[model samples]
Target: MTSTAREAELLPAEDAATYAEWFACLAEPTRVRLLQAVAVAGSKSVGELTEQLGISQSTCSHHVRKLAEVGFVALNKQGTTTRVSINPACCTGLPHAADAVMGVLAPRPCCPDNLACDVTVRPLEAGDWSAVRRIYAEGIATGNATFETEVPTRRALESKWLPGHRWVAELEGEIAGWAAASQVSNRTCYAGVAETSVYVGDAFRERGVGKALLHKQVTAADTDGLWTLQTSIFPENRASLALHHSAGFRTVGFRERIAKHRGIWRDTVLLERRRSVESPE
Candidate 1:
């Protein structure tokens, strides 16, 4: 195994202890339910949580104190009422902690299983622009793909997408979908992090075209030494979410009321996948 893999397999002693402390605080079923209640309600008074959880006030108070000690929940005082709210950091940190404990945090090889064998994924060629943009247009029409009203011009897309990381999927020799990674920032420090986008043509919605394209896209990103890939997906797009999750992506957080799409507010699910271990230089 590579040194990077070894490092991922073993968490630091200090971190393990810290994580253990946090986990220990939530060992009780009541504490877990308490945290969940606070997380969903955003904030709740002790009495409110007690009533919602069907637990006694004293028992709820004791468990809330335990969770607060580990920074899982925060306490606020307004007049005589003490309200408990979940620590926003825990929203992302705890999931990452779970991923670390389970070996899924480590990057693995391409995961193109049970995909349609006839669908071919190839690097985007110059002649593929027409089909690529047409597919993008289809995605725009769905009102769930992106906030953009129209497909970006080919020149604009080419300049934004990272060279050598653009791809096209073909079903029976016709372009069915496309995937590409765009540099998230111009700073040298963020060169390895990218925001990715994928779209399937209207005719190719459920034929495993997305699964095949993502397999090629993620594998290529790993080989090219990219360390992080992130994407924002509309919460309503369940198919896209499942596809990315299969490729090792995890939900980092939800951006509620994040932006306006067509004159109405919309929420987005922010997701990211980090390289499991560094590839050899």
Candidate 2:
């Protein structure tokens, strides 16, 4: 490993104290169980937790207190009764803390270097829309892509996606996959942040099309001054998640019951990749 990797593997001294506190809070199995129960049930009264956990009211309350002290759970008091809920922020913060300590979120390459030479990734062109939309339809049919039951029109996508950031991967002169970034917000403060999307054609499934498209997409975003790129993917889409991870994305957290798809509620894993400051513009 390089010196940079060595430095990243060692959790910084300033962060060690706080990370230790968070870990120590869950050192007890009962405390860990208490946090999990509250997290799953949303918000529950102490009595509800006690009965579900099969512990005495005092024991439940004691563990809850410990979790609350570490900012894992938030307690709301109401007329002699207290309801405990998992902190929404901690859902993402805890995982980020773990990644930081383990060095999984350390600075990495701007994009994958070993890209398939035969697959050509280039900026979107007028002729690429048909193929791109077709690939997107394939992803939607899988029922794990997005909540939208129908593919958006090319005009709609053109308006939403950043012009220079849109790209398509071609194999043997045929579009195999496409990737693009959409601005997350119109506000000036968030101009540097974007939400990304990538879809690969059915025929191109294991040919590194997804990887090539992501490498081009992320590298373009980083060079264009975009500091943050994020995406929410279905938990069942393991291939997409693995592709993004290889491109430097880290799991920030999981959003449970984020939306409904085909009349059934679905959850999504939120992942993000922040541009490394050391990377050249």
Q: List the candidates' TM-scores in order.
A: 0.72, 0.77
What does the lDDT read for residue 261 in candidate 2?
A: 94
Q: Model 1: clashing residue pairs?
A: 107-276
Over 1-281, each residue of candidate 2 has an lDDT whose tens digit, in order, gives 58877766677787888888999998999888888888898899999999998999999999899899989999999999999999998888788788887778776775678888899999999988899899999999999888889999999999999989999998987999899999999999999999999999898888988889999888888789999999999999999898899899988789999999999999999999998887665
Poorest 10 consecutive residues by lDDT, candidate 1: 103-112
Pick by TM-score: which candidate is best? 2
Q: Give the per-residue Cα lDDT of candidate 1 at 222.
A: 85
Which TM-score value belongs to model 1? 0.72
RMSD of 1: 5.8
**Model 1 residue 35 CA deviation in Å:** 7.8
Give the per-residue lDDT digits (tens) of candidate 1, residues 1-281: 58877886687898789889988887898899889999998999999999998989999999999999989999999998999988999998888788777765655555547789899999999999999999999999999999998889999999999998999999977999999999999999999999999999999889999999888887788888888899999999999998898888888889999999999999999998877665533
lDDT of each: 0.89, 0.89
